[model samples]
Target: MSGDYSIYTGQKRTFTIPDYVLFSLTLAISAGIGLFFAIKDRNNVTSKEYHLGGKNMNILPVAMSLLVTFLSALTLLGTPVEMYNYSTMFWWLCLAFVSAMVLASVVFTPFFYNLQVTSVFQYLELRFSKPVRLLASFIYILQTCTYMSFVLYAPSLALNAVTGFHLWGSVAAVGIVVTLYTALGGMKAVLWANTFQALVIMAGLMAVLIQGSIVTGGFQNAWDIAGNRSRIYFHDFSFDPTTRHSFWSVVIGGSFFWTSLYGINQAQVQKALSCPSVSKAQIAFFVSLPGLILIVSLCCMIGIVMYAFYADCHPMDFNNLITTSDQLLPFFVMDILGHVPGLPGVFVSSLFSGSLSTISSSLNALGAIIPRDIMKPYCCPNISDRSITILSKVIVFMFGGVAIGLAVLASQLGSVMQSSYSVYSVLNGPLFGLFILGMFFPWANAWGALGGALTSLAFMSWIGFGAFANKVSTAKLSPVFTHGCNWSVTTTAMTVTTTLRTTTSFTGSTEVTTIAAPSYPFIPMYKLSYLFYMPTAMAVLVIVGLFVSLITGCRDPKTMDPRLICPLFDRLFPCMPEMILRPLRCGVNHKGNIRNKVYEEADELPEKIQPIDANGVEVKPPHDTEAGVLKGGAINQGFEPIDAKTPGSEECITHL
Candidate 1:
C-alpha cells in the first residue's frame, strides 16, 4: 500500500505560473479568431459565408485546416502510447494517408467542388433518394458527436495527470470554448484557427523531442537505448487478417480508413469545397499530405524516445501513476519537465490545440449538414437565407453541448488509438460505400443504396462492436531502466530504492500469476482485425447494392446524367468491354456515350439549377427530401410533390 502511495505522490506534480500562461494563450488566440471573423462579417453573414467562408478561402490555410481537423488530440496522446506499448510499425499509416489523399484529389474533390452544395451528404440526395441522404447524414452526426467526446476526453486524461485539474473540468473547458468559436465565427474562424493550432501542435511535439534528447545525453543515445529494447521496429510483413499491426493491415486497411474520412466525410469535404476552384481544392488536398506525415513521424519518434528515457524503470510498474498506455506520455512529460516551469503547459496546450481544431471543425460541419440535409429540405423548405444562417449557429451550440455531456461519461478504455480507429472504421465504411455506389454505378437506384447501407451497418455493428468489447487488455513494453532512475519494491513494509529493474528475481515480490477458465469463443469473423472493418463494410455494401439493384429492375444506365458518373467511367465507356463494367450498362450503346463536358474541362463552376413555381416566380426547392429522384413511387409513397424544375427531374436532367 505504501509503495503504491509513493507512486501517486510522484504523479502529483503541479504547474507553475508560466505553465498556466502558455496554456491560457492558446485558448485566447482561438477565441480571438472567432471574434475577428464575427466582426468582419457581422451584417453580411449568409449561409454560404457561415458554412463555407463564402467559397473564397485561400488554399494554404484551408489545407492546414483539413490536416489538423482529422489529426486531433487522439493522434498526439494516443499515437505515442501506441509506439511505446507495441512497436513503431504504426508509422506506415502515414503512407495510408498519402494514398487516401491522392484518391481524394483525383475523384471526390472535383465532384464536390463542382457541385456547389453546402453539405457533402447532399451528393447522396442528388444521386439516390431522400432517405439515403438522411440516413447518411444521421450516421455522420452520431459518429462525429461520439468522436468529439473521445477527442475532448483524450486530452483531459493527460491534463489531469500533471495539473491536478479535475477531469470533468478539463473536458468542459475544451468543449465549451471550441463550441463558442464555431458558433461565433463559423467556417472562416474554424479554418484560420486550425491553421494556427497546427503550428502549435508541431511546436509542442518538437519541444518534447529536443528537451528529452538533451536530458538523456543525445539523440544517438536515446536511439540506441530504445533499439536495444526492441522499440524501433517496422518490418511486420504478415498477411494474416486478424493480425493487428501487420504491413498489409496498415497499408490497405489504413488507406481505406483514411479514404472514408477524407473522401466522403463532410468534416473534411466541407473544407475541401471551400476553395475557389476544383484545381485549388486539389492543390490544398495535396499540400496536407506532407504535413500529416511530418507530425505522425514526430509522434512515432516521441514514443521511442519515451521508452529510452524510462526503459529500465517504467513508471506504471513502479510508481503506479499510469495504468493504461494513454497516460504514458503525460507521465513522461510531468516527470521530466515538471521542474521547467512552462514546458509541461506547452505540451498540454498541444493536446488542446488538437482537440480544439477537431471539435471546432466538427461542430461547424455538423451545423452546416443539419440544416442543408435535414431541416431545410423536410421541415422548412421555404426558409429564408437569414433564418437558415441563424439556425446553423443554433445547431453548433446544441451539438457542442451534447459532446460535452458524452465526454463526462467516458472512462478508461483500451489503447486510445485503437479505440478511435475502431469506431471510425465501423461507421465510415458503409457511408463511403454509399458514395461509391452513386458515382460508379448509375443503374443503382435509391432502394438499392438504402438497402446496402442498412445491411452493412447491421453486420459491422455486430462484429465490430463485439470484437471491441472482448479486448479489455492492453499490451506492455519490455522495460529498460535508465541511468540515475531508481524505484523501490516493498513487501511487509520493507523498501529498497535502486537503479536496477528486473522482471524476475525480486526479493519478497508478492507477485503471483493467475489463469482463468476460457470464456465462450468468437467466430472467425468476430476475430478478424479491426482494421478490416472498413474494407469489409465497403465490399458488403457494393455487392449487396448491385444484387438488389439488378433483381428490382434497376434504372437504365443510358438515361443517367453524365455529370453523375466519374470522368474515367464516362470517357472510357467506348473502349471498355461489356463484361468488365457492370451488366447494368450492358444495354447502352458504347458509341453513344455522352461525355460530361463540365468534368472534361477545368471549368470555373457547375451548371446551376434554379426551380420555379407554376407562376414563373423563381423558388428554391423545399427540402432535399422533396428534391430527390423517385422511382415508381416506391419509397416516396406519401411524400410531398417534387418540383419539375429540380435537378433530378426530367426537364432539368438535360441541363445537368
Candidate 2:
C-alpha cells in the first residue's frame, strides 16, 4: 500500500476504522439503490425503458455506460501490470482505442443505420439463410457469456483478496445483483447503473493516484523515477505478425478487431441502437471516443505512480510487487481509502459496479437477440404477442445460466477480458465480413457467404496460433533496460535505500522444470488476445465471403437472406432495394433493360390491402396474440398490461 510509505505515515499505517453499524448501513444503502431501480420497473416499458433506460437517460449515465462498456475492470488493473513489464509505449494503445470509436462513428455506423436493425446480427438474416443468422447469434451469445462471466469473476477475486469477502459469496452476491437488476430493468437499468458506476470508478482511481503522488514527494520526483529507460516512449515502427502491440499491427490489425466488436457485436451496439433515432445513435458513437483517452491515460498513470511508491519499499514478505500490479490498485483502495468511513465501501461498490453494469447489458442483449434471431424462425411461424414477450424473458433466464457457467470456467485465465475475447474472435472476426458483404456487396449469395466465412475463420485461427507458438523466437536486439533506479530513495529520509529491480518475479522461491517447446497447446486461458485476433479473423471472413459469393454467379442482392441485415439499415435506406426490385422494361425488343419510370410511379400509389411481409417474398405471417398496448389494436399484449392501455395494443414494430 502506498499509504504505508514513510512520507505519508505519522503512525497512520492503521487508520481509524468505521463503526460497524455505519459500515453495514452504508453498504446496504448502496446495494439497495442498485437493486431497487433495477427490479421495481421490470415490466414498465422495460424492453425499451429498462434496456436503454427508456432512451431518455441523462448524458452523464450515457457517457458512463459507454466508458464502462469499452473500458473493463481488467483494463483498470491490467495496463499497470504491462507497464511494470515494459515502458510507457503501452500508452499509445490509448490512441488506438480512441481511433476505433472514431472509425465506428464515421465509417461503420452509417451502414448499421441503413440496416434498420433491432439487433446487430439482423443483417445476417437478410444476407444469408437461417443457419447463418443462428450461427452468428449463437457465436455472439457464447462470446458474451464467456466475457461477462470472466469479468464478474475477476473483480470478485480482487475484492476477496482485499476485504476477506468469501470468494463464492463475492461472486454470487455480485452476480445476483447484476442479474436481478438487468433481468428486471432491462437495458434502462444497465445504462443508468453504468453511468453511476463509471463515475464512482473514476473517483476511486483519481483519489488513489493523487494521494499516491503526494506521498511520493510531488510531481518531479514521481516523473524522474518513472520517466527512465524502462518506461521509454518509443519501441518500433515495423510490423511483426508474431508479436502483439506494434505500430503497424495496431493500426490495421486493431482496426479489424474494433470494426467487428463495435460495428457488429450486439452487446455494445445494441445499447446505442436502443436509442430512438439513428442520429442519436450516431452521435453517441462519437460521444464514446474521448472517454477512452481519459480512461487509458489514468490507468497507465496509476501504474507509474505505483512504481514510485513501491520503489525501495516492498510490502511485508512480498519482494516482487510488479507481478501483483493488477492487485495494487485494489489493495490501495482497501488499505488507504478504507480509512475514510464511506469511501472504502463506495470504492468496493464502485468496483463491483463495472461487472454489474456491463453484465446487465450483455444479458439484456442476449435476451433480445436469441429468441428473435434463432428460435422464432423455427418454433412458430407467426408468434403471438403474449408468447413473444414470454419467450424473451425465458431467453434472459436461460442465457443468465450460460453466462455464469462461462465465468466459472474462465476463472483460471490470468486476465478476464483477454481470455474471453481470444476465444470470441474465432467466432466474431469472420461474421463482420459477412455483414459487410450483405450490406455493400449486393451480389453476395448465401452459399458464397458461408464458404467465404469458413475460409476466413480458418486463416485467422492459423495466424493466431502461429503467433502464439513462436512468441519467444521473435526478439529485436536494441536491448530494453534501465530497470527502476528511482526505488532507492525514501521521500521522508535524507539517506537513500538503493536496490536493483530489472524484472519482477514471485517473492517465495519454487523449483522450476523448463520445457524446450510445444508444451500444452489448446488451453483456453492461454489463447491469443481477443482484440487483435478478432480483427484478423473478421477481415478474412468478409474478403473471402464476398469473393466466393460473387464468383459463384450469385449476382442478385434479392437472393440475400433478410435475417442477416439490420432492420435500421432498411428503414433508412428503403428506396435503394426497392429501386432494384422494381421491374425494368426491355423496351419492346429494343435490347435494353431500362427501368419503367412511369410504372414505378404508378406502383407507388397506396393499395387497398397492406402486405403482411414488406418484401414480395414467401414468409409465414407470424400469428400474433391480440394487439397489446399498441396504438391501433385491442388487448395490450407485448409488455403493457390490459388495465392501463389493453385495447388497441397492436405493436407497430417499435424500436428504441
- List lDDT for all candidates, in order: 0.74, 0.54
Give residue 138's error in model 2 in angstroms: 0.9
Per-residue lDDT of candidate 1, residues 502-564 (tens digit)? 222223222222234234364666666778889999999998987777765575555444445
For residues 139-183, write the lDDT of model 2, one tens digit per residue: 677668767777777777666556556667767776766666566
What is the clash tally of candidate 2? 59
Best candidate, lDDT: 1
TM-score for each prediction?
0.85, 0.72
Task: Go through the candidates in order and give the C-alpha RMSD of each one to the true structure.
Answer: 6.7, 11.3
Give the 10-residue window scoring lowest on summed lDDT in candidate 2: 585-594
